[model samples]
Target: MMRIALIGTGNLAIHLVHAFETCNATQLVQWVGRSNTPPKQARDTPYFTQYQNNMDTDVCIVAVADDAIPAVAKELQHIDALVAHSAGAVSIGELEPINRRGVFYPLQSFKKNAPLDWKSTPICIEANHGDDVILLEKLASQLSGSVHQITESQRLQLHTAAVFTNNFCNHLLGIGQSITTKAALPFSLLHPIIRDTFEQSFASQAVALQTGPAKRNDIRTQQKHLSVLSEADAELYRILSKSIFNTHNT
Candidate 1:
């Protein structure tokens, strides 16, 4: 069995704790947080408010903020174990001073109290040594079905793509909700169309599936939409409409 020490108390760390609990081959030896407030879900595991220089674990997983990774890693340098950080955009070099370094990035947005299925989540792993890479792969495989070995550059690109596809799309959905609410319509009314759009996008190229006034270059309909929206919404609509018009017609 591989003993693991997790360092963080954020959403990602919570998800990792829950995921590790289901894997019999892995044991969460310690959970290090900035405060003494123990996570309810990690009641069985030992909790420490500070980093221990000589942790007896196979690997120390730093699941903290991107900016805090370097300091956390420096503190763990004295430990004789593989050290890995869980940041998609942060490079493996941040874990300097430690000869054994790796990355264990989960490519998904996490909510504080949300539950996620570990089997479907994608895990991106990177390491300096081949053996360390294999070890990380083994641990990741136990928690997730989709695991890939990615370089720092590839991981950064994937993270940027995720922001565009997931974050930007969610913001657009929020705008849609606002429009519906203003019109005294239930947000549920848009659920079917939203579901279909996502399903279709997954089955085919999103660009090919594009529709509406912008895609058709219907200037009159685009102008009418802009006229009905608030100033902020109107500006956003104009920008997106122009982008779609240019994308399809030019």
Candidate 2:
């Protein structure tokens, strides 16, 4: 089994560690972190205090923040191993040339306590060499059925699209929940509608599945809903509605 060292213990790292542990082709040996690290109460994995001028493994995965990736790669410069980062926006080459590098990005948002279906999570990868890419693909394929080799630019575009589809969509849900709660309505009432929205989206094109007052240009109800929001939110709602209408009408 290939030995793997995972850096960081955040939400993504937590999910990744579990996936790696379950992969039959790999064995997670070291969990590295920054200096003055907190107590790792979450997992019982072995820990390494530092990454510089020391310990090596078959693969070193830096699943830390985007800004921290470069520093982590620099720290691992002296070590001979396949070094990679789990970042959507950052390029595989962001890590310096001294070490073999690649991207082992899992295209899914992770929560610490929630269980992730490894098979459903898409893994996007890029590598400095053919062998490195093959190695990462082999490892990711064992954990996830969906694995794609994409260019750095394509990965960045994917990340940007995720912000709109996942982040912005969640923000809209939060707003809907707040509006319902303030009006003395249970947010649970919207669950079915929300679930249906996603279900319909998957069954058809998202634009084709779009509905509500904006789709029909029901100006009266649209104005009423906008009136309930603050000036900024009202303007935002108006702009978004118009954009959605235009998109569907095109």
Which digits, one per residue and each the tens of the lDDT, describe model 1 over residues 47-119? 8998666657888899999999999987888788899999989989999988999999998999978779888
Q: How many backbone clashes does candidate 1 have?
A: 0
Error of 1 at 224 (Å): 1.2
Q: Give candidate 1's TM-score.
A: 0.96
Candidate number of the best lDDT: 1
Judged by TM-score, which candidate is best?
1
Q: Candidate 1, 193: how far from true, in Å?
A: 1.2
C-alpha TM-scores of all predictions: 0.96, 0.91
Q: Determine which window of 10 residues in candidate 1 has minimal summed lDDT.
A: 50-59
- 182-208, model 2: which lDDT tens digit per residue? 899999999898899898888888876
Q: How accurate locally, in lDDT, is each candidate?
A: 0.90, 0.84
In model 1, the clashing pairs are none
What lDDT is reached at residue 89 by model 1?
90
